[model samples]
Target: MTEQVMAAIDGSQFSEGVCDYAAWASRALDAPLTFLHVVDNHPQTAEADLSGNIGLGSREHLLEELAHLDEQRAKVAQEQGRLMLKAASERAVEAGVVEPRTRQRNGTLVETLSELEDETRLVVLGKRGETAHQDSGHLGSNLERVVRSLHRPILMVPATFKRPEKVMIAFDGSKTTRRGVEMLAKSPLFDGIPVHVMIVGAETGDNRSQLDWALTTLHEAGHVAEGEIRAGEVEETLRAYKEQHGIDLVVMGAYGHSRIRHLLVGSTTTAVLRKADMPVLLLR
Candidate 1:
C-alpha cells in the first residue's frame, strides 16, 4: 500500500500550518495526503450515581432529555469536525497536494490515530492544539500523548508555515540519534537538502568518530552533509547552529522510554521543541 501523510486538524491556531507542512511533506515524498479530524466523545454519566434523588418517571424524563441533548451535541460536533476537515483539505490542495483525503473520527485523538497509524508515513499536528488555545504556556496535551503512543515520525508545526530547505540532525551518540542518521541515509525525505550533523556537549574522540560516521553514511546515501561537534548545552548549541547556518528544520530522536521522560520534566527533546521556532521532525 502507498504511504500517506496524515495531518491531524483540531481547528487549532496551528491547524492551517499543519496542512501547509503536510502538503510539503506529501509533495516531497510523492505520497498521498490525509486530513484527519477527531471529535472527542462526551461522558454520559458522572463518577458517582445520582439517580437516587428522582422517581422512576422523573428519572426516565431526565434521561430522555439528557440523551436528546447528547444527540444534538453529537450532530453539532460532527458538523464542526466536518467543516474543519474540509477547510484543512482545501488548504492542502492549495498548498499543492492534489485530491487530498479528509476523515472525521469520533474518539480520543491517540486511539483514533493508533488504529490508522499503519497507513501513515508522517503525522502532522499543532504544538498544543485546540485545548491549549487559551493557555499559551501549556503545551498540547494530546500532542504529547499522541507522540508517546505512536511510533511513526511526527512533524510538529510551529505558528507559521514555511518549507524547509536545510535540515539539522542533532546527534548525541544515542541509539535514537544513530537511527535517525541511518533513516535519513535510506530515505528521500531529506533528499537534495543540506544536512548538518552536530554533537553538542562534551567533545571527545568518540563523539568525533560518531560525527565522521554520520557524515560518511549521509554521503553514501547521496546527501550533501557536513559534521560539526559543538560543546555547549543541547538547546543553546542547536539554537546557535540553526541561526548561524540558516537551518530550516531540526530532526531529533526520542529514545525508548516512558511517556513522562520523553515529554516532561528534564528532557532535551522537550527543550529543543520549546526553543525551536521552525518545524521539528521527531524520530523514534
Candidate 2:
C-alpha cells in the first residue's frame, strides 16, 4: 500500500525518456516505481456500435468480420502494451530503480491514472503521447486533461532524458504557485540542484517581495536559489532564462485560469508545454 511514482508509457518516442525520468524521481523520492500502459478502447467501442446497425446477409457477414478484426486488433494492442511495459520496467531497473513494477490495462490513460491516483505520489508522462503529431510544437492531446484531473504532481518530460543540473521556477506569486515553491522547498527531488526563480512582466514592489519570499523559502530549505525579474511575456521570458542558465528542468504551477478562458486567451502553461525543449514538472 505504499505510495508509488506512476509513469505512463505509451510506446511513443518519449517512452524512454518517461522511464528514465520516472526512475530518477523514484530514486529521489525513495518511492516504488510503477509503469502504467493503457490501451485505448475507442476503436472497439466504435466497431461495436457499427456492428449493431448492420441488417443481415452480406451486412451480417461484414459485421462478423469487422467484430473479428476489432478483436484481433485489441489482442495485438494488448500484447504490444505488455511488451512495452516489460521494456519500460527493465529500463527503470537499469536507471537505478529497485524492483520497478508495471501495469497494463484496457481504458483511457486519464481514467486509469485517476483510478490509481490515491496510491500515486507522482505521475510522469511524455510531453507528447503516441498519437501526437511529430511537430515539436504539438502538445499531447491528453496532457491537459491528465493535468486537470490529477491532484498529484505531474512531470511532463521531453523526448530525451537529461540529468537535470539546474532548475527554473516560473513564479507568479499566486497561491498555487506559492504551494509549488513550498513543495520544492520541502521535496528532495531537487535537493542538490541549484534553482533560479524568475518573474515575468513589470518589476513591481509586490513582485519583488514575492520573488524575495520564494528565494528565502528555498534558501531556508538549503537550496542554492536566486531570483530575478524580467519584462516580457511569461513563456518567452522563462524560456530565455532557461536557455541563458542551461536549465534542464522547469517547475511551475499550472491551470490556474478556467479552461474556457484559457482556450480563448491562451495560457502560459499551454504555451510553455508547447515550446519547452526540457522537462517540465507541473503542480496543479
Candidate 3:
C-alpha cells in the first residue's frame, strides 16, 4: 500500500496549523495526505448509577434518560467530526494537497492511529490536542502514546504554522539520534534546506566525533549541513540555539533512553514539546 502523511485534527485552535503543516509535509514527500478525525467514545454518565437511596422506578427512569442523553451526545459528536474533516479536506486542497483524503473513525485516537500506522509514512499532530486546555502547556494526552506506539516519525506542531526553512536536530550520540541522522540524510523532506546538528553537553572527544560523523553523513548526501557541540542544559541549549539561528523546525529523538533513565531523569522529548513554540519532528 502507498504510504501517506496522516494528520490527526480536532475542533481546536491548532487544527488549522495541523492542516497547514500536513499539506507542507505531503508536498515535501510527494505523498498523499489524509485528515483523520476520531470521535472518542469517552466513558459516559450512563455507565454510573449515581442515584443513591432513590426508589427503584425512579432510578430506572433516570438511567434510561441518561442513556438517551448519551446517545444524543454521540450523534452530535459524530456530526461535529464529519464537519471538521470536511473543513480540513477543503483546507488541504486549498494548500495544494491533491485530492486529499479524510477519515472519521469511532474510537480512541491512539487506537485508531495504531491500526493505520502501517500506511502512514509520517504523522502530523498538534502539540496540545483539544482535550488539553490550550493555555495549560500540557502535552496532548495522546501525543506521547502515539509517539511510543508508532514506528513512524511524528511532527508535533504548535498552535500556529510557518513554512519551515531551517531545521535543527538535537544530537547526543545515542543510537536513536544516529539513526535519525541517517534517516534525514536519505529523506527528501528536508532536501535543499539547511540542517544544523547540535550537541548539548560537555564538549568532549566523543561529542565532537559524533558531530563530525553527522556532518559528513549529510555532506555526502549533498545536504547543506553544519554541526556544533555546545555546553549547557539540554533543553535550554536547544531552545537558545533555535532562537539564535531562527530555526523553524526542531528534529530530535523521542524517548530514546531507557525507561529507568527516563523515570530517573525526565524525558527530553516531553520537556521540549512543552516549551517549544515551533514545530518538532520526533524520530523514535
Task: Compare the candidates by TM-score and give the number of the best one.
Answer: 3
* TM-score of every prediction relative to native: 0.88, 0.93, 0.94
Among these predictions, the greatest lDDT belongs to 2
**Cα lDDT for residue 108, candidate 3:** 82
Q: 116-234, model 2: which lDDT tens digit per residue?
A: 99999999999888887889999887887898788999999987889999998888887878998998899989999998998886889999899999999999999999879999877
Candidate 3 overall lDDT versus native? 0.86
| Residue 107 CA displacement from its true place in model 3, Å | 1.1
Candidate with more favorable, higher lDDT: 2 or 3: 2
- Candidate 3 Cα RMSD (Å): 2.2
Worst ten in a row by lDDT for model 1: 257-266
Give Cα-based local distance difference scores for all models.
0.82, 0.87, 0.86
TM-score of 2: 0.93
The TM-score-based order of candidates, best leading, equals 3, 2, 1
lDDT string for model 3 (1-284, tens) is: 89999999998888999999999999989999999999877832235557666788799887787789878988998999899999999988998889999998998888999999999999999987776766646776678778767888999998788988998999887888899999889888998989999988787888888899999999999999987888977788888899899999998888554445563123777788888889999887
- List candidate 3 segments past 4 Å from native: 43-49, 257-266
Q: What does candidate 1's lDDT look like per residue over 1-284, in tens digits?
A: 78799999886788878888888899988999999988776532223456567898799887787778778887998899898888888887777888999998888888989999889899998887776745544567777787788899998888789878899998877777788999888877788888999888677889889999999999999999997988876678888999999998988885532245544322777777766678988886
